[model samples]
Target: MSLQKALLLCSKDAGRFILGTRPIPRPGAGQVLVKNIAVALNPADFYIQKLAIFVDEYDFPAVAGCDGAGTIADLGEGVRGWRVGDKILYQSHWNPDTAAFQEHTLVDAVRIAKIPPNVTCEQACTLPLALATAAIGMYADYAQPPGSRSGGAALTEPWAEGGRGKYAGQPTLVIGGSSSVGQLAIQLAKLSGFDPIITTASKHNFDYCRAAGATHCIDYHATAYEQLPAAVAAITDKPLGFVYNAIALSKESQDAAWAILAPNGTLAVTAPPLVGKANDVAEDGKRVAWMSASVHVGPHQDMAKRMYGALTGMIERGDIQPNNVELVHGGLAGIPDALSCLEEGKISGVKLVARIADTP
Candidate 1:
């Protein structure tokens, strides 16, 4: 067996280190061997390292990373829907042998999506994880009609289509419009018919957030939380209906969010909110939905597949543009440096994508 280079984490607190020679994995049943070309880093990568969330200590020398864009080099038995040379992108929570950080990967066929012709490998790498999270969070309760699997694909049933009476034309707020998930959530909210898609971001990102479909951009740092209630009220005193808090939810921010919401409106939070009693409930008995999404979660397979299809369709049609990405140049060596920058929160408004290979 040929050896491949991979970034490995030997322990929960391990800093990324390179393994010069690890056996390249063969594609298992329902899997495809991909030559990875690009990998995108997310906060969870460092958080998992810092917090040591994985259960198996014996599973040391773990490969880290969740999102990548690559090409199918070979397919395993029983795998369909993909062929060698097909360019694709995927996000998975499985172990490092199948992880995105390796030069080669064995990915489950179900988790992969063909990269549209218009998207670059770097651009495609950024979408899977963030889009998957957004789609799942926004459409958790949605289900497609029976007999809808056509062309070996699953159909999507957006929450709006289900006639969820609470969200229609509701004043929805995206707490952090500039974050990758926040950017996608803003667009999804607009697509789902949320009126006055409100968001809170720094003034620097105001224009970009608006371009992505935010109807109102409140400067969260510069402006007081009290101002949000009045601004939301000015638009329509109907109460803020769905607030997607994509930022670090503090008690203050959560309380402010709850204050502006109408009775029974829903609040969806993405980040770990500041644990406080006030952050637990909306003022009007609205539902506070905390989104705990990770690519590793098994139950999201169907949702992930459906979302990749729809998001790919949207990208192909030019409906949603890729996030502003800064492609890192150091290849495998760049992983540690890029990760350090990410941990410091120095990277803002642009995602850092590392090229793992020269080709798709």
Candidate 2:
């Protein structure tokens, strides 16, 4: 076995990330080993450090990263439809060997998507975590069994038969439109033919949100979140059947978005609900869906496989565009500082990507 450089969490306490070496993990059945070219950072990376939310099961020195793009280096038994050199992108699991912060990582082949010819490693790296968050929140049918809806709004997916433009003439709102997940949410809403796709963002990011398919970009700084309902009403009298709270952690934003939801509508939040009972009914019949953005587990696995199958074509045809990327220097070594920028709210509307293969 060959050793490869990785950014290890060092301890169960999650004190700090350190440069270290671990043997390159071999792909198991139905898996692939990827030599990661680029890795993207998310706010989860920061929370995992400060709160150790996802590292609990691991022993000390866990690797933690969620998004990666690279070329396949090896394929395990029964891995079909993918060659060793195919350029692809994937979301990582919780295990250190499977995480994305390492030079090489293992991924279930079914969850990996081939990169389109026009996309770069950095841009592809931004799609996995954010896109999964938005997709599962909007399309996954979590409500099939009574009271069993866990992750999504229970809407039909755009890639499914007759799912495209399924919601034509409907109106929807996306809180925090400039966010990576918010941008994808806006584009997906457009594909669903939602009319008057409204979103909230900083003034500087109004155009950025609009380019991602938002029909109206409300400046949250100028118009307070408390006033979102009135503003949304001014755009369209249609009741908002769907609300994607990309900034669900903010109680104000969550409440504002929830306040605008129509009867029988759904609000998909990245964080656990801060206002209403998640998956429970209110007097008005609005339901909240809390999203867990893992493409590797449970219903998400099948949803991811179907979504990944369609994503390549979507990118090739420009139906979906990758997020704007800002490369962070120093490879894996730069992630901690970049994560700091995320924690301090210094970065916006663009993903922070690192060329992990450039680690020195």
**Which candidate tops lDDT?**
2
Model 2, residue 165: distance off in Å is: 0.6
Task: Return the clash pairs for model 1, or none.
Answer: none
Assess candidate 1 and give its TM-score to the true structure.
0.86
lDDT string for model 2 (51-103, tens) is 88888788768888999999999999999999989999999976988999989
**Which regions of candidate 1 fall more than 4 Å away from where they truly are?**
14-16, 55-58, 142-168, 273-284, 358-360
Model 1 — which ten-residue stretch has the worst lDDT?
A: 146-155
For all predictions, the C-alpha RMSD in Å is: 5.5, 1.3
Q: Which candidate's TM-score is highest? A: 2
Clashing pairs in 2: 142-149
Instruction: List lDDT for all candidates, in order.
Output: 0.70, 0.90
